[model samples]
Target: MPVLDLLDLPAACPPGTPWLGLDLGENTIGVAASDTSRMIASPLELIRKTKFTQDAERLIKLMNGRNVSALVIGLPMNMDGTEGPRAQSCRAFARNLDRIQPVNVAFWDERLSTSAVERFLIEDLDLSRKRRAGVVDRTAAAWILQGALDRVRDQATWV
Candidate 1:
């Protein structure tokens, strides 16, 4: 399926199926998964960068294994609320993934996601830089996913 609006996800996806969240980076792909209730998002894995085909294959495999209904990909927008090269890259990746598989896809604004995760890791969790490095990406994925899930839930409540 083509990329759908975030609000359309609950309708597009099968009820009770999980949604996969992705934070793509230059060298790694952070992965998170929402619970079947779509109420909680948790860090799942960090995939090292590889060829696009390989990355998509791994993502598809993961989605299949977990019975995921859709993907919530983070679009790294600029602080000024503008699309940059990174956001463009994410869009392209989402398009490619959609073409490769039939799952629904949506992009969520991800400005400051990584920084927020970093701050929480250092200040709240008191994780050292070295330890943080190993988990930051996946944690950021959860952060992104949580934001989307919150919005989705809020929108549902209004209706």
Candidate 2:
């Protein structure tokens, strides 16, 4: 499957299968997974940055383990709704992953996702900086996945 818009992702996804979410950073890839019902998402694991083949192999193994049929990858976009280099990198990553495994892929605008998770960690969880650093990426992956899940659910209601 090719990279799809968020609205189109739900259709591409098979019923009763989980959706994997990825927050791709320069040094790490934060992973999250949605429930079979697709109503909730949870942080899963963090994959350290490595070669593309290694990274994709890890991701494919996780997806197979969890029976995930689609991916929601966070696209780091500028505030003004423009794609920057980071966004392009994410797009390319999705495309490359599709070529390797051919799973449905979608992009969720991830503007401020990391900072929002950081604020939650500081104010709500009272986690120290060091603790936050260890978990922030995966937590942000959940945040991104939750946002997409909510949108998909709401769209289903209207449809």
lDDT, candidate 1, 1-159, per-residue tens: 768999998899889999999999999999999999999999999999889999999999999999999999999998899999999999888878877898898899998899999999999999999999999999999999999999999999999
Query: What is the Cα-based lDDT of residue 148 in candidate 2?
Result: 96
Q: Candidate 2, residues 1-159: lDDT per residue as tens digits?
A: 677888888788778999988999999999999999999999999999889999999999999999998999999999999999999999889888878899988899999999999999999999999999899999999999999999999998999
Note the Cα lDDT for every prediction shown: 0.94, 0.93
Q: If candidate 2 were superposed on the true structure by all CA atoms, what would the RMSD be?
A: 0.8
Compared with the true structure, the alpha-carbon lDDT of candidate 2 equals 0.93
CA lDDT, candidate 1, residue 156: 90
Q: Candidate 1's C-alpha lDDT?
A: 0.94
TM-score of 1: 0.97
TM-score of each: 0.97, 0.97
